[model samples]
Target: MNSDPNNQNNFEHSEYFDKENIHHKMEPVTAAFIALIGIFIFYQVGGAILTILIFGFNFENADINAMRLLTMGGQILLMLLPTLIFARFVYPHHITQILRAKLPQAKEVGIFIVGLILLLPLLQSFMILQNNLLEQISSTFPLLKQLMNLLDQMDKLLEKTYSSLLKSHSFFEGSFVVFLTAVVPAICE
Candidate 1:
């Protein structure tokens, strides 16, 4: 029956702010809406600025390296920056807790490697099946066949562009490429 606002025990026993099972202050639905809006805005704004800086009104073709950098940088900005902002300033959640992330033990890593090795044949079979299905569908529909050919051309062009960006002549360059393409994206997510 203590009527003291400053009593530490009061907060400990409160129903709304339970010390035992406190959760994120922001509602899950609100957080999801904010996340979607943040991503949309960040992608549109960041891509525009990058394009202006790199291309400068020349939309015909962009340098492969510049395009690669832009794509990676955009993802970091759109995904990682907003999440960090919300976690630190808005809701102030622990990074590990919010992300549900932890460094896996060596045994976990070994198990993952074994799983991938065991699944390789099945994964390959699925890829082949997918391609065969696409081919069959395209053959049945002339319009779809034309559309598929166009998509294939576009895919090849993109593949070539990405390959050009990924080509690294030296060890340091290769490491940088991996960092930009793999490490940075993983961290952003």
Candidate 2:
């Protein structure tokens, strides 16, 4: 193992109990609460902005299919931007510490790649299961149905934005254009 400044001295001393070396030692419950709040705020603000940009600006009664495509493009950006920002700035230390801990291990890298490949199918399965579960719950519970309705409203807002955009350009072109807009800011940042 290579000697890392963050972990080497502690390993030498065998003082594994030391909390100082741990990155972000806040309680899991506290972190979960914060994450929920963050999700709520991000969805409300990001969803609103995406809807306005995609749907509100391109006010017309033309091609519905085109508008659908643009709304999808907007939704993708809305979902991705928050996650990228958090990873790059708000939680950069976590990524650095993880990389340092794992540091250039061929076996670890191989395992990680294999795990990621496996996870793709698992994630799709999970999404399918989540949708089915939500459907069942909505049928059984009024509150679940209400929550689903709220989600539907958000989806409609996103779709309206997409439809507006599609009216102007092909779906691929619109997505590529929006992606370029995002990339410029990312590069500058």
Candidate 3:
């Protein structure tokens, strides 16, 4: 057999380790905890800070399109970028596998489309039912009256904001909203 250490033929005969990969450098649980902390810090807390910096304390007067753009930026920069960099450090050799960096087959895509189409109505109905149940429970439990009132106030504010975000005046705007609301989350998640 050839004796060159770097040769492919010697792989079976010799134990090889890629020193560049941090696969054995950290415990899996430690790595996962670090990842969670990183996500929370950069995406959750940082996104909130960034929003406050740009939009001030009140979210009421923020422009809808700009808010949508900021949300997309947070997904890409604060969330996706850091996850990618961390994966590169800890899983350089298996980066693609770590990130699921592969296109699905057409059949898989079709099945996902069909599943989403069927699930949409069920999801909407569940949301409506949840709201109705919340109303009934709040009345049955007087202690929950204040909590329900708070929710009702916030719900009205949120509904107006979400309605503006979801509305589109033209086809291009609708496509952008779809990318912002759907495609970005699908990829980032």
Q: In terms of TM-score, which candidate is strongest?
A: 1
State the lDDT of candidate 3 residue by residue for 36-138, as single tens digits.
Answer: 7988687989988998899987788898889999989988988888877877777767665445344566898999999999999999999999989988998
Judge candidate 1 at residue 144 and give its lDDT: 92
Give the best candidate by lDDT: 3
Residue 117 of model 1, lDDT score: 97
Candidate 2 local Cα displacement, residue 127, angstroms: 1.1
The Cα error of candidate 2 at residue 70, in Å, is 13
TM-score of candidate 2 versus the correct structure, residues matched by position: 0.39
- Model 3 clash number: 0
What are the lDDT scores of the predictions, listed in order?
0.75, 0.59, 0.80
Please write out the lDDT profile of model 1 over residues 26-139, one tens digit for every residue: 876888788788777877787778768877764437776677677787888777887777766444644444454546668989999999999999999999999899999999
Comparing 1 and 3 on TM-score, the stronger one: 1
Model 1 alpha-carbon drift over 4 Å, by segment: 1-20, 25-61, 85-96
Off by over 4 Å in 2: 1-114, 156-178, 181-189
**Clashing residue pairs, backbone N/CA/C < 3 A, model 1:** none
TM-score of each: 0.66, 0.39, 0.64
